[model samples]
Target: MTTATTTAPPVLHLAGISHTYSGQRRRTTVLRDVEYTFERGTFYTILGPSGSGKTTLLSLASGLDTPTRGSIAFNGQDLSHLGLGRYRNKHAATIFQQYNLLTYMTALQNVTTAMEITGAKPATGSRKARALQLLGDIGLDKAMATRNVMQLSGGQQQRVAIARALACDVDILFADEPTGNLDEGTAQGIIDTFSDLAHQQDKCVVVVTHSQRLAAQSDRVLNLRKGKLTEQANTP
Candidate 1:
């Protein structure tokens, strides 16, 4: 007698999804018939040129917006059925290229506020401690963490945004040009954190960037061009 085996569904799946933006006299289709599956414990990087709809793809997949055609599913349940807001609140976190930090709040406050809003609990210690540790891990010292974001440099604010997202404890982490504002060494550290989040913590990480160095570090590299996306060979 032989036992049967079962396979788990993808953490996120996009099936024949297409998105179009309407203008005054025309419509622009950014993605066409895009089908892909994102699994947990994997790091993915998306590379694309300007006007190629990389951000749009990220928005759709991250539940910021729905596709004009087709469906997106999280763990086999359609996003439309699951409710996009609910999905975002419970399962996904995004680090935007603009480093959308609360300018009036200190770095530590921004991270802790996000944790509170997301109801993310630390494995140990209080949320403030966890936020401070995450901030420090990304090169922000205690003094820097206590300073208002407006006083921090662009790169420092970027680190705070990353820390805020990381503290959320979401299943999938999405980033757009995550390291564009950082120095080489700091950027590399962020890349290492992304890898660790996927491999060690069993989370899915997706980043949209134009940097080949960042792309080279991911498990899968996908290129989006002319409204289409294709995966390159595995990075080994």
Candidate 2:
């Protein structure tokens, strides 16, 4: 008897995707024919200048927005057919640069609420247990976790955002300038967490950052320039 082996499709794919912002008098195009394939168990960092549209690309890939032209797919299925809201809730999690936490909730509440909304359940414990653990892992202790997010500092709130995303237990993780508000040590720890998510957990981790130190640790380095996305050779 002979057995057949099947390979899984890429976690996320962008095919000739372009995006533009239309205004009252004129339209501005940010991306042009951007094609990329992101696979599981890999960490990717996108480098670009302030106006290079890295956020737009991340937004499209994370299902927060659709491209102006072309298409995006997850696991070989087009996002259009997959339903953007469903994709975002069930498959992808994003850590916005602004740390979009629920203002009325505590740090722990923020994480647990995300897990609840995403329908993520822990294998061995209650959702509260998992949320607390994830928050602690990101350096927020029980005291900080119990406090409202507004009471926390910017770096602390950023950690809460990261914990919320981690608790979602999604397939793809997207982060934008995640370390911008952190100190050096904390920033490095977050980078390590991202690396572990990709290599250890087999998740597709994509981060948009201007930090070369963070980019150097990623498995792949992508650069967005002049409305084009290109990969740079890995450097030591």
Clashes of each: 0, 0
lDDT of 1: 0.96
Off by over 4 Å in 2: 1-5
Lowest summed lDDT across 10 adjacent residues in model 1 is found at 227-236
Clashing pairs in 1: none
lDDT of 1 by residue, 14-129 (tens): 99999999999999999999999999999999999999999999999999999999999999999999999988888999999999898889999999999998899999999999
Error of 1 at 108 (Å): 0.8
| Model 2, C-alpha of 41: deviation from truth (Å) | 0.2
- Residue 165 lDDT in candidate 2: 95
Which lDDT tens digits does candidate 2 get at residues 1-236? Answer: 99999989999999999999999999999999999999999999999999999999999999999999999999999999999999999999999999999999999999999999999999989999999999988899999999999999999999999999999999999999999999999999999999999999999999999999999999999999978999997532
Name the TM-score of candidate 1: 0.97
Candidate 2: RMSD over Cα atoms?
1.7
Candidate 2 global TM-score: 0.97
CA lDDT scores, all candidates in order:
0.96, 0.96
